[model samples]
Target: MRLSLLDRSRTRAGRPDAAALEATVARAEHAERVGYDRFWVAEHHAVPGIASGTPAVLLAAIGARTSRIRIGSGGVMLPLHQPLVVAEQFLVLDALHPGRVDLGLGRSVGFTPPVRRALRRDVEAAESFEDDLDELRGYLDGTGPVTARPATGRVVPTHLLATGRGIEVAARHGLPVVVGGPVLDSDELPDLLRRYRRDFRPHRDSTPWVTISLDVTVADDDATARDLALPEAWALAVSRQTGEFPPLEPKEAIRGAERPAQVRRRVDASLDRAVAGGPATVRRRLDALADRTGADELMASTSTYDREALLASDRSLRDLVA
Candidate 1:
């Protein structure tokens, strides 16, 4: 399986968001240098912890720094913006970095009610994702009412960050599918993938493609690896309970603080699912996972409190699989 990255540019406890974004560009260069397949950025709004609210802008910055690696949105929420505008943004990106741009689209709504209002979008906006995609496609292909400038007749290959319904959409359009998160940690993903492949229509570009994304942290030893992952794990659990994704606390602070029993359960549940360990152990786990899932690609969506440890894990994965 090929390795790719999905960076959210996570903000740590003591760091400013500016640094988190700069770190993303640096990581993109490093990913290119280390031979990663693609460098993808995420989009998250109204969250202090995530800095990648504008993937198109971030991809432009990434495109400026790296020459060979593929740059893309891990996904743009199609429901949040005008289809014509979104198409033009990516088309312009293609102008800057032709043949190296990918457009990954999703149907997710805002993180909260206020965020939903801020986007001028309803919660059920995703119910119209197919229509949005069609319009976007028409604009990119120069088949829409008005020609989308700078990208007329130019095609940007698309991928769908899919669930059950999203998978069907991709199949109909002959596009690839990016699947990740809790789905990767479960027993259900393999069957779902199998079903997708079985049901895919034979469109010109439609072959079954599945890229699994998950949190992976590696260290010289299992204990330290888990230690590195503690902060983000805690942040995620806290988000579950509070409905707000907070900045990542330092691992030492996370270890020193006290927590409720419920928080502990959430953390344990997360850590149990995340891939955290020393090299050989991680290699074994990753291999077994791919073998069972038949994953064509692995999107290593890893984050940690310490930037150095996080980058080191990013670099180390290649040798383990080599």
Candidate 2:
């Protein structure tokens, strides 16, 4: 199976935010060295834990640093930007990087109510995502009402970051679907994907594709790998209670802090959902996931406070799946 990465440019508790972007670029370089197929970044506006709010801007930097591996968003939220503008940004990326660019679009709005208001988007704005995706595809394919600039007649591959409803949109548009979160655990997942493949309409030779994304961390042992995953899991747990996702704290710091029972339970649940262990353990779980979903690719969205450890996990994951 194809192995890819989704780096969110996660910030650390004590480091400057700029460091996270630099770290993301450094991680992309490492991903190429480790034989990863694609090194994708994410967009998370006004979130304290995530330094990258703009995928295109960060992708340009990543492209300049690496030549072989594909670099793209994992993804850019369509509800917050004009379809034409989004097309232009990615068209420019394709202009510079050529065949190495992929456009992964998601329908997520801003992180919080304040962030949504800041972006001038309400919950209802997401209702336009399907239309926006259709319009965006038109611009990308040079069939829109007006041509998007730098339209070099190159088609940048678009993948939809999807759940059930989003998967239906992808099928209707004949685009690949990237699935994660609750849908992956649902008992109805097989039926959902079967329907997606069955209903997919062909657009410009497009075919049904599925990519499964989730957090994956590897280390010398199961305990160590789970420790590396703790920071991200804790950040997620805290976000639920406080509604603000903070920077990744050291695992030591997380363990040292006092927490309420609710926070502890949330943290345990988050960890349980993540795939983190020794090589054998991770491979077993991943193989089971692949058999269950028939996924075409595995996109690991793993992060840790220790940069070296994160890089090691990336290399180990590549070795396991390559």
Best by lDDT: 2
Inter-residue clash pairs, candidate 1 = none
Return the TM-score for each candidate structure: 0.96, 0.98
Q: What would the per-residue lDDT of candidate 2 be over residues 1-322, giving only the tens digit for each residue?
A: 7999999999999999999999999999999998999999999999999999999999999999999999989999999999999999999999999899999999998767999999999988899988998899999999999999898778999999987788898899999999988888899988889899999998999999999999999999999999999999999989999989999999889989998899999988888889999999999999999889899999999999999999999999999997
Root-mean-square deviation per candidate: 1.5, 0.9
Clashes of 1: 0
TM-score for predicted model 2 compared with the true structure: 0.98
Model 2 bad stretches (over 4 Å) = none
lDDT of each: 0.86, 0.93
